[model samples]
Target: MSISGINNYNYQNYYAGARHNMAKTGGEIRGVLSSTSSASSNITLHMSDVGNSGNALTAMGFPDGTSASVFQADDYNPADPEYRVRYWDKEGNYTDTMVKVNDIDPQNASYLEMLAYTSYSDVEGLTKNAFGDFMNAARGVNGNISYDADNIKEKKDYMSMVKELMQLQYDSNNLPGYLSYKELYDYMNDKING
Candidate 1:
């Protein structure tokens, strides 16, 4: 059945519109309790309970009795895979509406952990050429360079490169206008040492 302006059940198409609406309005299509406080002024919504309670259907305007028929089987088991409802507010502030599903239930945790692990794995694969170049430039002869005692060789190599860059900077009139490398290095070292 279709709501007046909304289309009939078409999972793939429905989510796009739902996401768009939630993003534009800073409104939620679903939410779960995160925690509860004994203080009368604050009440937390346990998202899992909300999910298990099948409140999303009611918010979507499904009749109370039909919630199970609409969302779950006769046994009242969840049909959807684990997921948390989240969106950014109108002012671009991020709001996490629910704890990730995996964090809620140990049984449900694998998928989210796997997703996180995969994302970090991808980040690890990213080449650091830009960062390496920036580090190299920073160490130039005009740059104060120092290293911890643990990796003397690596530090020496880095400082050697920095010295070359500093020489180049000295030869050219374009050294950065900030404090000299020695002064900046001394201040930073003092702060760290203290």
Candidate 2:
């Protein structure tokens, strides 16, 4: 049950029949296990076969020809990353293709900071206006400037403040006009933290 130091397994030694050949090349192979049994389980394997002149092919095999397929580098160029392996069927229709994969690298700290600053600057003007309106409404009630109509002025003032904050967050985050409940929560967090 304890598997350690099993870093690599070589399969070139497993091929025995004259129908198969082996070569050393750099690539990956993927397959799936068919069943849970140890002896009767079916396994598929792929191999990169390189000729003497450094040409390569990705040979794949399964239990049947109709179910299994192989992809090989047609225009084999050793130095190019854009080179790919293409698969085809007996009818000459394309099936699958493989290409080099890479991940995005995050190395520009200054650019990230500039993006954050620009995002902040783009929303500053709207935030200021919203804050001003909320403060004015709050002051109108506190100063008794609207005494005649109703005392719901305090509630209205608080609602306006909430609306202003919500708008600020929404506009800053570039959220859609129709706000979802989860989006509102995320906007609040991003506004407070970012």
Model 2, position 26, has a per-residue lDDT of 21
Clash pairs, model 2 backbone: none
TM-score for each prediction? 0.18, 0.19
Q: Write the per-residue lDDT of candidate 2 for residues 78-185, one digit (tens) a residue.
A: 343222333333333433333321111112111112112222222333222322232233333233443211221122323333344446435456343214322333
Off by over 4 Å in 2: 1-55, 64-80, 90-92, 95-98, 103-194
lDDT assessment of candidate 1: 0.29
Give me candidate 2's TM-score against the actual structure.
0.19
